[model samples]
Target: MTMVRLDDAMVLGMNGAQRRAVREALVVAYPSRGRLEALLDGLDRSLAHYAADQLPLPDAVFAVMAGAKAEGWLPLLLAEAVAVTPDNRQLADVVGDFQVGDFQVGAATTGRAPTTPPSDWAVIGALADEFPDLPAARPLISQAGLPPGRQPAWNVADAETFWSEVHRLLVDGAVVDGWPKVLLAAHRARPANPVLAAAVSAAGATGNPGWREISGRP
Candidate 1:
């Protein structure tokens, strides 16, 4: 299996809103400590590059750093960067907030970024189109849990089975990674299925409660 690098510039060039949406999706889909560290490191590198070149820092950088601060690593990670790149005025200004305790370290370590929310389905569809090869980019039924040789019929039986499996996976604390995209893919496949529609809706609801539950699983 080919692994996509998180720091790909093409992926990073998304407009502020889209980039934030994708980052939120990634946090929910892959909540491991290692994954979080990689993301933080990527953000650090991007910020350092922007600082080194004196390029205007993208809005997404602050947004992502805020997320890392809330995750409790921003202070430590930014401190390291601040130590290494003292001449990066922009980086110094951002890290100053953490040093002065303007931002609070969150009690919780992992979750969505606190900001304007976007439609999960729309974001998934857009990302899938924009970055089709990335594992988390496409939320196809085939990637969720469809059995081999079976196509997504979106029939009642298919809908019920799919929903049941997803519910079971979530409740059993299984690693249902990329499930949000999977649910959205199902909704797209059968827009009229109440179960799927509701699941999709719930997945994108305020604070993304459904997604939090899924991501909370081991």
Candidate 2:
């Protein structure tokens, strides 16, 4: 309940109630024309801090931001947020959730409904551009299909050939060639396939060198 300033590190360690209290304090302090700007600035600083440290931001931050989104400035605030930290995956997700109007959890699920006219296709397009390999961005690309050239054809003759291509792409260190996108596409097509799921999981654990080892690379 203390009114200390909430920063990325401080918010990360707070429990849900404590986080809520901080958000409430923010609302009280910035009650007028400054409200949305203050909220967006805090969010930008938090996201920038995490991105600079190369660390993952916790869901708590997004939870509070979602609460703010319900106050009817979702698009403008989120668009500016994403513009400031486009590479932040967690921020991308918050934008994606509102874009699709999927407010199943967090403060968004409370009695306060999200403002109508959810994020438009332009915002979704920006997210897809920043995170082409992210599964979250895939669906937002277009109902017709994945983005141009990024889509894997998956036209192999057999299951073995399909997996062979996947493995080759991984082992050859073709990550820059969009191998992760291919792996994610495969997982989406066959969500029940354990191997595909594991590959997607492994691809995400990029810190582990085992997945990046090239047999003969100098």
Candidate 3:
């Protein structure tokens, strides 16, 4: 494969093979150094490190999200790639703007000429629009979350609600919250689960300042 430099205003499109090839190059040549990049979404590798439990990544989603967040990215691009992953529980378990699995099914069926609307998608949209976006995203957000409502176009209300719900799901652990702080809080709350503590500690890179810092984890 050849390296093609992409710039802002110039969207880069890649077949799965090309994208995989590039990801391989970064993994082999840089070995987690983050030498690769994406001008729009910051870098694909960046999203891979965030440690999302439902994400089917070989890397960590938290690390990726944190890196991109640190780089001041909006996570709009990788959001598309990761939007419909197999494990996208979105928000049902954790709490956010989407339920990944349901969202994907819904998104795939949206505006279809022959397919019926995914039930979950319709439910989520109806719920999100009802209250400025919360409980709905606790399972699924992103364009998939939009469904038949002016989708593919990010709405201002959706974006704001997205961040708000993410803060709850990811940082605050309102819905399952996250592993690190929750682990810490659990420990503080008494009767903590050692398995969980050890699991979190051993699940990813430690001391990340963002997400959790288990060991060489997700």
Give me the candidate number with maximum lDDT: 1
Off by over 4 Å in 2: 1-46, 51-117, 121-126, 129-218
Q: Between prediction 2 and prediction 3, which has the larger TM-score?
A: 2
Kindly report which residue stretches of model 3 are placed more than 4 angstroms away from their true locations once superposed: 1-60, 91-218
RMSD of each: 17.2, 16.4, 21.1
Q: What is each predicted model's overall lDDT from 0 to 1?
A: 0.39, 0.37, 0.31
Q: Residue pairs in steric clash, candidate 1?
A: none
Model 3: per-residue Cα lDDT at residue 218: 58
Per-residue lDDT of 1-218 in model 3, one digit per residue for the tens? 11212222211334445434333322222212222223223344433344443332214322453454455542243343333222332211111122233332223445322322223222222223222333433223321122333222334456334433333444443333243433333223222322223333443425555433312235
After superposition, which runs of candidate 1 have C-alpha atoms over 4 Å from their true positions? 1-141, 145-163, 176-179, 205-218
Tens digits of per-residue lDDT, candidate 1, 1-218, equal: 11111223333234666534333333332222233335456555443432232221223344555555455544444445445444434334322323433332221234323322233433333333222332332246445543434332334342234344444553454434446646656556545433345456666633554444323422
What is the alpha-carbon lDDT for the whole of candidate 3? Answer: 0.31
Per-residue CA lDDT of model 2 for 42-98, tens digit only, reads: 545333432232211212234445644444433444445445444333334333333
Model 3 poorest ten-residue lDDT run: 90-99
Higher-TM-score candidate among 1 and 3? 1
